[model samples]
Target: MRHRAIQILFCLSVLATFAAAQTVVEGSVRDTSGNPVSGAELSLHHTPGNTVQSTHSAANGTFRFSGTEAGTYTLTAAAPGFFSSVHNFVLRPREPLALTIELQRQERVSEQVEVHATYQTIDPEKTGSSYTFTREDLERLPDPLLESSNDLVTNLMPGASDSHDNFLAIRGTEFSLHEFINGVSFLDNAQPQFNPGVSPQIFETVDLMTGGFTPEYGNRFGGVLDITTRSGADLGGHGDVNFRGATLDNYDINADYGGQAGALGYYLFVDGFTSGRYLDPPEPRELYDFGKGARAAAQLDWKWGSKDAVKLLLMGGGTSFQQPNITDDQLVGRDAQRHLRQETGILTWLHTFSSETLLATSVYARDGSDRVLPTTDPITPYSFASRAPFTLGVKSDLSRYWHGHFFKAGMDLVRLRELESFFFDSRGDPDVFPAFSGGLKGGQASFYVQDHFSPLPNLTADLGARYDYFDFIDTAVQLSPRVGLAYHIKKTKSVIHAAYNRYFSPPPIEYSLLASFIGHNAVDPSQRVGDVRAYTQNYFEAGWAQELRPQISLELNAYLHTGHNSFENHEISISRIFVPINFHTARSNGAELVLNLKQWDRLGITGRFQYAVARTYFYGPITGGFAGDEPLAAGERIIPAFDQTHTGTAQ
Candidate 1:
């Protein structure tokens, strides 16, 4: 492409902006092709703090950003398939800035304007690679009586579908992901899944950072899921009861764990859900849940000494979904259909080293042994698995106007292990079916460095990288790098953002399938993913942002990704090894749009849409055999099953 930009500003009148006042800015966005881009974004920025106040874009290739301050600022226009453009102007005291911004053909994308949607905006200056979830987001809106935190993960950015029961797949890696318990990796392995929060009501925030984080984080090609519990706004003890008619009935009560003595703080929370069967007069069979769900948690904090502070969190829950299953011979329930039980726990601590350096560590453990527990055949009815991982790390950050440059450094170590067991069904053609199972253990350590360079007031850039080591595989050393930049449109409110990040992902389980044939009455059945070897993923995205007004703005982003040695979740059988031989790769492309309205407080609205295709072919020899209408046709691909023809959310 070529270096190009187009900035158009339509001010209703230059004299009207004499008195500073709240105003509006509305305009149209077109391209060199003389075609109007309907979803193009318009952004307006106020001076100082640069807080994102609003966002919006209308149909007919037109956008209106209202509630802006009457100050001399800039206006920017950006769209996925166009070049970055800006409009610099002087907003006097009153009236509105009616401007038109036209973007050129595809050109280099900038950092701030890189994301096609408003939701992609993150304060990169604060953290490099972190995914945050605002508790108020529609996805977290309190559900009637949901029991498990396992299913809540699907709503997170970069999170995958629920593959195996309770089995989570992060990025392309299935089970290698790290789940945190209040910042500490799990030490117990009894939870049904890796998502740590059991009841959303107890947590105030949930963040998941896939990679490119500071040294304080541990080793793993996957990512990290962090949970923060809410603190009691009041000091006095408080309690409340939640009573409602739904699939589950809930009741809760909590107390402040500290008093006026010394310097200590803590809060306790306990709640339980009764199955419909336990209700008065009892509920119908169709709604008769086989088990009740219960959970309890506590958050504690205190000053360890003069310059140190310590915080601790405790949480646990129990849940199961039992359904009716019958065979041809008996109408009565011959097989019990159920979602089993799991346990979880976590602990974390932190100490300060003056204002420039801080030290901290966390420990997490979880056990998921909730098996079928067949009522008739109680002995080895199903499989039982557990995982425990510990993390220790330190961080040092300096904040000063030293040459107008910022720097940071950190390092961390992680230890991981898994205990698994599997059993065979008495009716599984018992002859050929083998009763087998096994477990695996591994550990790793990693470190990283980063720096943000600001040479001029209108220009900024960031660079960083990380290295990790593993024991299970040779050449364990791995590197992850990231880069970003932003350019301010002279003195205007307009700015552009573009970034590139390189992350590593573990392959599926099939790559390790050879292990099953070598075992004697012992096997893991499948590794991390759906019985497929792990595959690595390298994603690249570019987009832009615009401050159309102080209260309304918009963003446009486009991305193309490349995947090598990709693995597919396929069938597994003896003698046949694993279905779909490994060693395959592919590519994909897509775009997204986001809108925000700050004027409407009580009513919040957001929307996102994506179109991408991922495909892979059998790596093994296929000379004479026909590829057969493409094992995965363009319109027939399912890698991203949720890649709906039309996916959306509204409230």
Candidate 2:
């Protein structure tokens, strides 16, 4: 009877785990001697595919994480002077027993090796007009705005404004895309659209790939951002607290750490934020934008049987954003209130087979919803929201550090559980507010292979291609080829660099839905004109990098770009939706000048000046497709959206 009762209770606890409405995970890290070590970078990978979070250790050498969903994961940490520590861990409703770490530092008593050898880290001045900002910079610097990474990075650009107080445009480009965690794609692909929705507490380093990019990158027509997250071990029990307020109160607390030399190591973290109340002057009425959110991510690593290491990670979070109602009589076309809520969960496992190769697989889910009270006269739904586009993928990497050629080969299998876009409704039909759904079950798949060949000490070349298979198209393949050459003027601390490449982008799903709602009048929309063909862009850049001194530098780049399959609004249709009928070829040329002055510690300035001319030739309206070859009836060239004739930025 006793044994039977015990089994019954165990079953009950397992079932209760899922109903907790929340999950909790906790662990720690240490050195081989079982002592706390700070500044270790840690990354949490969830199951299926989305990135959960990454963080670094605090002064106390400790950490803690909570509010997690049940799943699998792998945690990895490595420091410049220490050996790598990889851990695997799991989670439930409540199953964490204070973990510890005992790391083994590489005992190298011989010739020293400098680990930071990247182009920007080794010498910022040699790169001309760029400056790298570690997390430490954001800690000491003061930002007048709140919860905006884009607003901050752009201000640091070579030719940005001292403050983005208004709708500021750079050089002629109205929007700039910033990548998250080293991803090639910006979090929100649509430029100039924002709400300061991201929280910066969960990041590592933000690299500003402003210009002179190699062949690996595609089109944004402006700059590239490469972000690397913190994936090191906790090494000790330490955490931190940061808070800032504008119209309300914002508070946050974070803790995480790892275990000792034992076969099992662990890490955990938890954070949250809430706001106060305020008002807007437009309505001359009281307003309140209240937001509350929380997150927890943790991991454990298990290495057994000598050569095998398995890592487990569990992550989950919830957030809520709301606003008070606005009265119709008090304003024009806007909303009275808005509410947004999202819940996320992730789990992952990474098994390492050898020193030169590893396989990582993960799964992640996001349940996001929104509500709004816009005017009844609006054509679209009063509230815009989506719970689709859930992501899933698998990634693997093979690397070999040989004598003359350093090689790394990897591939990512990505897709969406829902349609590429679930917000579209054709036939001028009304949106099913609060019930937004994407009709796509299979979106797109991307595959690529790249090689880095260095024939000399200061010169490097690369070649690669990305093939994408989308929902509406048969197959889209982009051949990306690029080369870079740099020369260092021996002892003068100056370098010159030149690069050339091409980029491609297909019309996204949102444009398709606009077509569905096509009407007979000027506002008519359709499902994308004649299954539009592929679009391509060519890029060319040449620049010089000069380091006058340790704290000062300058860079100048001249560029030219030409595009194929350019889509524009068809003159025959006054509709805001799409009609793929109107098409054109484009040409853009520009030059940028960047200057840096960090010569004086604690007091420095950086800025840039840009000049570009954008023009497109739209073939006249479609007549069996050949008619588009003629110029538009209006005869005036259309200016590129990114074109900003004379623009400047400073920081």
Candidate 3:
């Protein structure tokens, strides 16, 4: 009967262990003589988050850390008559680990030992293929074009193709497709051109993910550009200023000020620049075109307590430029000048409910406007258009760990408004073409949940799904699933990773409005075009990374993406107005190889090579298959104008 009762109690305890939400870490501390070191001070440090927990050893040299999250941590022990020691370890979700540490006597003759602690929260596991750049890295890169811009950094990366002047095409896909600032969409007005308005002087770090992105990021088929700005806490209570000038009569000025007092901190940044066009021109014309822009940002941070914090950010910028209209390799009398402005405000709150649970919430709004003014030359036929796009959004995310599984769930809601107008001619004549103007208001919502499961010490799997809904599209709900696997070979310090994901990109709100205008003349609103749908793609990727030596590494990856129902502009009867239509399907495939070597930290060398193939097919002539081809047919394939077969870069 006694043995049976003991067995029943053991079963009950095992069941309770699986039901618990928190985890614990316990260990013992001993001196050089293998004796219990009671009252020794121990500190636990959580990387990236910088949260700290401390306790003293018990009378039996045992220490217990209860209610702690699963993550990478650094533990340190310090006591009198002994040298301090540090250890780095990973805590698995809901798993208890026991460890022992032995301290040496201070009197032992020894030399100083240097220890380096690096916090790499961006890619802790090194399972993804990406490149990270800091503010200093951006300044040292060679520039033959004599331009200081973000594009310079991306164009040099492996697998990057840039045939166009400003756009960056990766793996044969569209350029500048996805951009994020602090995990939120930053560039919404991407049609005609896409440019990140933030200045590099204020950027703390930039990460480019070419493959193996997490499920939390969606809505783009290409790569992702993640940018994080600097905070006032980084500078403590100081200010900085910088100025750069080149031979092309170009000049730039940037300034910043930041400081902290008590529990509050503040930061401010401003930049202004002018790129003189006369120094370098495509052609020698009597006329000239120049570029000018300015950017400014401010931030405030507040710490309520050990478990709560708040951050507020404000940013605004404007860009203006002029381009000469060229016909038959000659300058035309009429030129085009454009001005664009963007502003954004955001507030974020972070609270730690417990060691095993953390919550983050944010509210943000952004606005963008554009104006185009052309020379009023009667002979030249010019178009005038103006637009104002606004977005208001709210987001909330919750993270928890349980039973060796890390879970995250989040949702976002956004409202959009676009006020726009356009005309065929800007010669101050109404007879040329009647102006078309309208407004659109809509909203979008998304929810996602992801789990990072570790079934073995060397293997990890990430599985997740996301659902998106836009009120303006015919396909109201779209679902996307993502999965990735990673394995670490302990002996070789190498990693092998693979992933498969489904991607969806809803047509831009501005373009959707253009499609709705197809029925502007119809008396009944229900008769308007109703067949419009969002784009979808399936992506497959596999890669391997290994460090050949202490300062040299190599990486190779291959990817393929197949997409359908892609959106494009099709002219109607050669009229001035163009309507958007989903008229084509495409396939893009590519492979990349990169070799990096760092010798002595003062000089670095990098080489990249890539090969890509892209082809598009149209179903029918109504979808603008081919205009003047003699063999025009219902189903035909052709290469896009932007597609490039092979590209390479070395630096």
Task: Give all candidates' CA lDDT scores.
Answer: 0.41, 0.41, 0.59
Which pairs, if any, clash in model 3? none
Model 3 over residues 150-211: C-alpha lDDT tens digits?
44444545566554223445665553346565556632623323232566555555566777
Q: Write the per-residue lDDT of candidate 2 for residues 231-255, one digit (tens) a residue.
A: 3243443455555545556554455
**lDDT, residue 480, model 1:** 70
Give the winner by TM-score.
Answer: 3
Best of the candidates, lDDT: 3
Which ten residues in a row are the worst by lDDT in model 3?
Answer: 623-632
Range of the 10 consecutive residues with the lowest summed lDDT in candidate 2: 569-578
- What RMSD, rounded to one decimal, does every model reach? 16.7, 13.1, 11.6
lDDT of 1 at 249: 45
Which of 1 and 3 is ahead in TM-score?
3
Q: How should the candidates be ordered by TM-score, best one leading?
A: 3, 2, 1
RMSD of 1: 16.7
